[model samples]
Target: MFRVLALALVLSVSFAGVVPNPATDGDRGEYVTLSVPENTSLGAYTLADGETTVRLPDRTVSGLVALAADPALARNLTDARVVRVPGFPRLANGGETLVLRRNGTVVDRLTYENAPESEVFADGGWRPLGATDFQTATASDVAVSAFALPDAPQRVLAALRGAEERVLLAGYTFSSPRVARVLAAAADRGVRVRVLVEGGPVGGVAVNSARVLGDLAAAGVEVRVFDGPRSRYAYHHAKYAVVDDRALVTSENWKPGGVGGHATRGWGVVLRNPAVADHLAAVHAADSTWRDGVAWSTYRANATFQDGAPATAAYRSDFAAWNGTADASVFVTPEDGHQTTLGVLRNASERLLVQQVHIDDARFLNATLDAARRGVRTRVLLGGAWYVREENRALVERLRTTARDEGLPLRARVVDPRSRFDHLHVKGVVTENAALVGSLNWNHESVVENREVMVQLRGGAVADYYARVFRADWRGGVWRLPLCVLAVTVGIVLGAAGVMWRRVSFSGSGRSGVPRRVPRPPSSR
Candidate 1:
């Protein structure tokens, strides 16, 4: 009898320890994320919404389970186990209560109120999905080597070749054959080399990029891709590399069009600072070491690559490298990049110069306009690439119209490369006191969802260096008479010439004893 009692006691303890833990309640409206305790089987468990109860699948959950109502949301979660709970109780946006039971006994319960949209609640707080907590780092009097793209590609190549210990390259895309060759050479010299790139860029990964990554892997370089359904950021879009004690941050990709100097105007800087390099290295380690960062070979095995022609056009170098020491603050997104950049725009007391692919983000556009309204001179130069030409032209017209209507000291135009380089691919800002250069695009998604890197150089000299480049590019983007205006001007001049010819012809005809009428000149409207 005593033995039977002890067995019963042991069984009760085992069952009690197996209860599921309610970790997070993701009330993303339309769907919910049910955080199940790891290694805990839900075979005897049912989840209830105080009305209907559904039995969970009889399997051990890895960690997170999604109860999605939308089929599309279920499809997007390729990595996570999802239950399509048709008629699943909709999570009340304002508040709700959920309960989990095992064998008709309550195991866990969750109660939340005023749930924020598209955010996950856990550990007594709510945060957006994949949000990071990186803080801005300020390093004073750091040596910086600044260079402009299509002009100082060699600067990047030389930095890689000079890596004596390690090279951690992070980028949105990597397909530069020249850069690949240099990295391979560095690896062969016993320098540790690792590369991290986005596995699922827009339109999918390119065939050339896959080929380049394959070659790097074969050459003994550790190459990883930020992919899989558990990815933290929507996209790993930072374009920077940590080489030994130096960090090279840029607004361009690793493709031929970007750092290879084949095309695309960009801004880059090589910081010879240990602290900055360590900070970037830590970020790389955290990102690359995550479960979502899969090996390139593994990702390529299942990826369908898209066909693309490599950028091969060459251009003459226009700007030389500018070396100086300045106070720099490094920032990354979706953490401090947005706030730090807004600080830069809001604090501009004199003038603001911005060069970018385009400014589609309303918040940033408003900030720029607000600066102009505050008596700060503002100029925005946008890329003139074929893909963005129409949109940029339309945006330029809108800004011009607004400026004229409000009488703001703001001017915006599209760049004309003029054989200097290809389209403007720079995401840079220049003020009298500071300059920002990096991969952060001025867009809501890029600021809040994508992983980006930017550095603010706080010094007049650094600002002046980029300011000079902006001035040159601004001149290239200078507004000229529109075709219609030019056509009207030519029409007026030709009409005047014709009127003179008609008067002279009439006089000549009068001499021939026949009266003739002279045509009047056209009016200039």
Candidate 2:
């Protein structure tokens, strides 16, 4: 009679839809994810790894659950239901099969091989959450406007203020008071304003960002944060906004240092293209509607924020918006961004100018070097900020040394800034025929983990505009002869002069006896 009752209870709460998801080998450890039916009972159920079988705990579980080798290995999945069965077989890193059974009968099974790192497998494939494929929007005579930071802050403000129907802003960080106010005002005026920002930024959330988000929430703006245990991307680092039918994409955060024109040199563009706007809007929707996305109020309810200083200094706008037309191809990271960037580099035939905070990723650096090897003149300009000085210097030296050894037409140096703007913050690529501008940093993690956006603008006018900016920044990293070379040249000149002095008498004024000041060797200005 007791066995009959137990069977009845098991039948009452079925694990009918429960199936093994693809196994994962990520930062935490190797584990198998399962799609368990909501409120499903684990009674009479067991998981098998062909060699060993262990009964699952007799409990009710719903949603995705991780059956881990070590339950503690899935600690970062705060929202997942984790289970561990004693005597369970270890999943092989190379490949493995998992079977789920109920009442000693097979219910579901999955087979996979060589699980990828830091990626979850689902729907018969392995991919990062919120990742998208490369797509291009081509329209002849499309109105595109180019602008630079600390120069045209008004362009951003004007776009937000002009919005009548909808506004969707996505960024890694948002703490700019002026931009926040504009968003609030737009919401107040009946614009359907929405914001999506990274909840777990590199250094944690800032107090000012929290404050700004809170203010926007209070103003009735729909605010969401990409956070929680099941976050799709490692970081929601894309910066762009869709205001009605216009799209504004930038390499800067919507902070005082960025759009507020206070600090950092950045590149931005406003495209009056419906297709572009629609594409970005779709991206925002996908990132914000997922399970990991949390309402601003909900995220802030239990979160503590750190104090941060806001950038306050202002500067005059030097680069005005360049109005032009171009075909734009959009790419998102952890998906097709890296490939698109590589395509741009590989296609360079005449010259390649790269301006970035830093290029730590070997793949990108190698691609740039390959361009130089192909006889394409290449110039790599890295940031000169105090924080990145040492690393940038080392990287610059390595690149220069490689160029010298290989006899490639490549030059690399740290930016001098020259007071044009504070530290280099732009992540831009200018080739002979194309320009890529967006928020993707040239790094492994950025291209493989973070949610980044980049646009390749194809047209002579657009390429020329960005190339112009690149040239200006490149000049800031002034080129000078190496100290050794300069020393050798000076030694040769001085030796020749001494030989001449011994051979011929100079008919000059007595003042000529006084040593003429030798011009100093060129500096890394």
Candidate 3:
């Protein structure tokens, strides 16, 4: 029975209007019909069975299906005693009829046979926008905390605070009590706060992840949990903030434990570009269109929210200059594929420095080894927790032997994540001097499942800074340093054999292409 309830809860919360079906008009006449006004009550409704259900609230005298992008309408919706239908892409011919009734009485039967779009009820549906087309809207910002972001957050917060407008932030998780406090403070100052957490139980429903929910609530924040379906293990992990007119986007989730979670480091960017933020906010608006999913009386946010400094304190991005012109040092990783990065390093005339957490794909290993053989010096900084990701252990061991045989200078040292289990979530690729940063993970899963973004930074202080960090890790005697030094020396000597330093350079595209020949005097970028 418990299993069935849990299963039912998980499924119902997966979509919008997720309340269980009412007892039917025959059983309860205290309800109103949607279109026909025959019988409609929050007590019961028909469920699509394993798909979605529209549970009405006892307080709901009627229901409203609004799809326009209106914050006022969206925020005031929860108090309307109405069921917010989850908006989805419908397959039916441009027609969707939304009928509403109060106390078994007909109220409104709005129909749009030619809806611009309709949401096909799925386990998960996006937030609904108003019916009126939402092309453009003015923006106002609010300052939540003492810290500042690059531009978007700053401007958005400014507007919010000045205007005392409502703010809705969407991200994968929200466990930062400090952030929560800031939000709470904002609420205390009379600003409305709402967060659409990916891991919430359902639309404004809470089953688990209560700490996350509670902190925000204590701050006078209004949170709508998006339980739109998909997977119990799945979540809406996108990060963006929708202020009055702008939004913020980046690769960061708002969780305290996540920083050191399982050895994976993360990244985020405060997208100040209005157009970009607007588009992202639009997406957020679309997701919250309906009060969908099964109603969980309560939820517990698995993670905790502790006070802490911003994420940038750990992984920072500083602007650099090239050729006397200051350039923003932005390297984004769009999930997984590294063709662009590989091309840059493939053209390397001198060296390649890599620091990654895991690599289930052997091709990437071969590529690195191949670069060494072509005369370009290749160095690798591996995570100590690679064992946790054993799928690539054999490949790594094989690469070790090949490095010994060809003397192609390939060394690896795992970063001892003693303080954190396996949180080394960074992907850095360098060539002689150029560096790659952003958010791409070097794994088959990253390539296939996750969306990543990255940037190519060439010839500048950032590149040099990356090199310096590499050097410190490579030569520093932390557990993996000695092994790295030996590997570097061996790959260089074996590959180079007797080639003089002055005569050396990458064999192909400035980077040593294969494991066939040894080059000399790698050009120092």
Candidate with top TM-score is: 2
Compared with the true structure, what per-residue lDDT tens digits does model 2 show for residues 392-474?
99999999999999999999999886657777899999987789889999888898888888888888788888888878877
Writing each residue's lDDT as its tens digit, candidate 1 over 241-356 gives 99999999999999999999888899999998999999999889878886678998899889899999988877776689899999998999887746888899999989899998
User: Candidate 2 overall Cα lDDT vs. reference?
Assistant: 0.79
lDDT of 3 by residue, 95-205 (tens): 344443333333333343332221222123322222112232222232111111121223223433432555667655565554566667677877766776654422432
The true-versus-predicted C-alpha distance at residue 231 of model 2, in Å, is: 1.5
Which of 2 and 3 is ahead in TM-score?
2
Model 1 regions lying over 4 Å from their true place: 1-120, 123-131, 477-525
| Per-candidate TM-score against the hidden true structure | 0.71, 0.71, 0.45
lDDT of 3 at 242: 51
TM-score of predicted structure 2: 0.71
Q: Which of candidates 1 and 2 is the stronger one according to lDDT?
A: 1
Scored by lDDT, model 3 comes in at 0.44
